[model samples]
Target: MELISDDAPKSLELENISRRFGNTYAVRELSLSIAPGEVICLVGHSGCGKTSLLRIIAGIDTADRGVIRIRGEYVAGPSRFVEPEMRNIGFVFQDYALFPHLTVEQNVLFGLRNLPRQDARTKAMAMIARVGLTHLTSRHPHMLSGGEQQRVALARALAPGTDILLMDEPFSNLDRGLREQMRDDTLSLLRSMGTTVVMVTHDPEEALSAGDRVVLMRAGEIVQQGSGYELFHSPNSRYAADFFTAFNKVQGIYRNGQIHTPIGAFPSARQLREESQAVAYIRPSDITVTTAQSGLSGRIVQRVLLGEIEQLAVKLDGLEEPICVRSLDHRPPDTGEVGISIRSEAVLTFPNP
Candidate 1:
């Protein structure tokens, strides 16, 4: 697949959007644009407004203030609101939202009730085949696997000929292995159709691997938005860094262009203001453990063997806290005496309050 450029404009635009629930703000003055054919995943903890924003876009909920435009035509604003059915948008709910009493074909054709009987049957059958459910069209929702039921919901949503798709944790109900397979398959189908999608998920790995762009939300506001690689390597805030990956933090002080921490004195990346306190963050992969006498001293406290890597907890001299380090090769060290070293380039410092 060719790389997608940043300048493309097949986009969903939201400007100055806000939603409130009486005294509490659900979404606070948010603004963003998702490109055409782009799978933009909204990620945050529960009650962080990610779902609320998606609901607003789907016309299921009204925004307190803002303008929403799809392909440059205004669809939502303070004085104007489009009904959910007229928005020409498809929605896949978290629970699969299939009617238990209806057959697969009937469920798929449910949205086409107003159309002529022959036309609705033709469209529903075509969608069933498109979703690889033609063989099970006569069966009810309970007769299918979790993944199959999810496809039925997807086909039903796509039957309406909508280019925009909104999904809310569509795979949460599936088992782990099935969830991964469904995610890949769903993404492939949507991309093949050039469908623009906005999905809400709290999983970081899912957001990183499945989205063309990832938006990280916290407490009703967008904290960071960027491509997966960019956000992983260059997070602008501690929350983003901690949320996306594991990091070990150490308190230290900067003096004379170097930081003095429990580990040791290390050169700073940039000149620091005089006598400033700071927090240094380093990923578990960045620390190296060795028996060499030249490195900082620490004691191995615990060792946990994960499939691909082993996590070690170490208590260092002069540092009261324990730090975690991950290694692909596991070499058990003595619990009370093991030396560890910090890589100079992997250290990230933040201003201390």
Candidate 2:
């Protein structure tokens, strides 16, 4: 891994990018700018165009309309298109696309065919060792574990010394425990190399934990984007709020710019018609269950222990469905009756549609 040049251009820039398939648009007038060495995670549901956007950036698919500039040079636009191989962009596919017959070193060396044989072999060995695979350099893909195969894919993609790399759900194939380890290890390696990365994933927690910036897309358009803290703490809409975590939506009425629900009155951030319907988004963790009668009266209908936290389904007096509350207290109240109080500051208010 080498330090990125200070004089290098912006890693990537997409202006009004769009792609269509028959009557449906996969990517719609999407625009984004990525800084050099930044790690960005593209997250959304199945048909949100996240993978489509990644393919366009890697030149695997052409944009129907827009301009793409990589490292300050035009790559794709209305009048020009660069071949995927000539774009100097590295891509790690979801399957860890390695040749079954090629050894670890040989797989990496394949990407450096443009260099002399000795030089390519030397650089390939260095990349293999950088990913901690020097001991398995002679092993083929079938002989390696999922994590090892992933490392080989990364080594091959990065051995070319390309500053920009695109990964599509690189860690999705591994099991839960191994997935976290591989994700952390992979990120550390990419950051050490000062590589500009655009990774696509459907997991919200992964997107929040892995990216320097998380781009949330919906229906082929960007719904919201910012740091993990920004998207989690200050979502702009109900859709954005629900994507990050589960929220207990409490319907309320808008009165004098405030949402008045059965539990409490919360400040509304969005302007709504007077007397129209409003909703409060509250996280299960944000609600506290107390034995004292200081808050709303609710009876615990069910309780389940989830390792570190205990989840309780509390049914309020008038609410149709029970609201869920998660607590980390070692001695959570027994399943029977409890008082529910929401953290006012953590409440997110939006208009009911």
The lDDT leader among the candidates is 2
lDDT of each residue in 1-353, candidate 1, tens digit only: 23555476756899989999998889999998877788999998899999999999999999999999887778899778889898888999999899999999999999999899999999999989988999999999999999999999999999988889999999989999999999999999999999999999999999999988899999789999888887787787778888899888888898887777877776766566768997787899989887747577877888898978999998887777789989887775457676677887767766675
Best by TM-score: 2
List residue ranges in candidate 2 displaced over 4 A: 1-9
lDDT of 2 at 18: 91
Q: How much lDDT does candidate 1 score?
A: 0.88
What TM-score fits each model? 0.92, 0.96
The clash numbers for all candidates, in the given order, read 1, 0
Candidate 1 Cα outliers beyond 4 Å, as residue runs? 1-8, 256-258, 266-272, 332-336
What residue pairs clash in candidate 1, if any at all?
A: 10-36
The 0-to-1 C-alpha lDDT of every candidate, in the order given, reads 0.88, 0.91
